[model samples]
Target: MPHITPCLWFDDQAEEAAQFYVSIFEDARIGAVSHYAEAGQDIHGKPPGSVMTVSFELAGQPFLALNGGPAFRFNQAVSFQVVCESQQEIDTYWEKLSAGGDDAAQQCGWLKDRFGLSWQVVPAELSDLLGGPEPARAQRVMAALLLMKKLDLDALRQAHAGG
Candidate 1:
């Protein structure tokens, strides 16, 4: 199968955004960085040597950050979901990604990062808690989930257990 990579558009912050993401994820790294050329100056409006694209990887998933200007902006329509195994993992990601983010945009384990990118930091066992034969348990867990910003695995488990 052909490998697919997510391309992120930034307003002259491709390199900066890639660096920030690399710093947050343990298995992340910045790869090739391409600069603009004088040929496209009229259309791109960027300096000849300015950064144009930054290739990066987060949690082994390849991504490309493009300095495509401010014509477009990130919204909640697209989001990256981080499945964490523990509350500690969730807390770390939530803290890092939500830093300098809009507080009003945070709800139900979803947050907008400093770069305006939306992220969903959820527990690994979320499916199990919200699924299964017991509809009441799942409903309770869903109710609990709807009330929080960053997800609490313990609270979800408690709700699933009818506590």
Candidate 2:
């Protein structure tokens, strides 16, 4: 099978960003490091043989970071969805990764990380509710989801009750 992974280009904080991402998600780990060889890139502020690339995983998703120039940045076009089970988990992740960025509820359990990386912190119960046989109940749940950020299950149920 062919192997493929996302390669991220960072101005100079590839390693730091990798560490931050790994710390935020479960099942995350740094695999290896690649450094520049002979040609020194003083322009990028790193020595000739310095670390330039980092291989890391977030939520079992493999990602590579390259210490390239500031030619690209993280945008809302791509985001990560963190399916959470409890409010405690949502609070923890929200408090941790929401640092240095605007944490606003975007309906249906979605928030933007400090780096402007969008994330959806949804409850596991959402799957159960959405999978229910009753179409009206599911519609109610959907309507409720449109007004939430962290996906409060209790509130969603109440919304289903027309409350």
Candidate 3:
């Protein structure tokens, strides 16, 4: 089967971003690093032999990071969702991803990483708790979730249970 990979554009940090992502996810690894050749230095305006792209995988998902210059940037319009099984998982991702990011951007489990990449570190049970059979309980969970920056699984569970 064919696969489609999401390509991320960065100013000059494709390799750094790829390495950082690999360190965060257990099943991730840096696959390849390609450098710019002398031919396109005029049009691309990049130094010859500089990093051009990086191939990597995060938790089994393939991604490509390109040192495509500052023509584009990452914004909240796009985000990667990390479905966490436990609160510890959420905490880990939240702390690491938000380390050098904009603190004002954190809300409802959504955060922007140092690279300006947006991420959603949410509890795996979040969907079930907010879309379960009980409408009132789910509503409560939604309300609780809206008030949090980093999701609190325990608080969500209590809200789901009408506590």
Best by lDDT: 1
Each prediction's RMSD to truth: 0.7, 3.0, 0.7
Task: Give candidate 3's total backbone clashes.
Answer: 0
Segments of candidate 2 deviating more than 4 angstroms: 38-47, 104-107, 161-163
Q: What digit string (tens of lDDT, one per residue) describes model 3 on residues 44-139? A: 999999999999999889999999999999999999999999999999999998999999999999999999999999999888999967899999
Instruction: Give the per-residue lDDT of model 1 (tens digit) for 1-163.
Output: 9999999999988998999999999999999999999996999999999999999999989999999999999999999999999999999999999999888999999999989999999999999999999999999999999999999999999999999
Residue-wise C-alpha lDDT for candidate 2, range 3-49, written one tens digit per residue = 67988777778888889989877789998999876665645666677
lDDT scores in order: 0.96, 0.75, 0.95
TM-score order of candidates, top first: 1, 3, 2
Q: What residue runs in model 1 are displaced by over 4 Å at the alpha carbon?
A: none
> Over all chains combined, what TM-score does candidate 1 have?
0.98
Report how far residue 152 has shifted in candidate 1, in Å.
0.9
Q: Give model 1's clash tally.
A: 0
Which ten residues in a row are the worst by lDDT in model 2?
101-110
Worst 10 residues of 1 by lDDT: 33-42
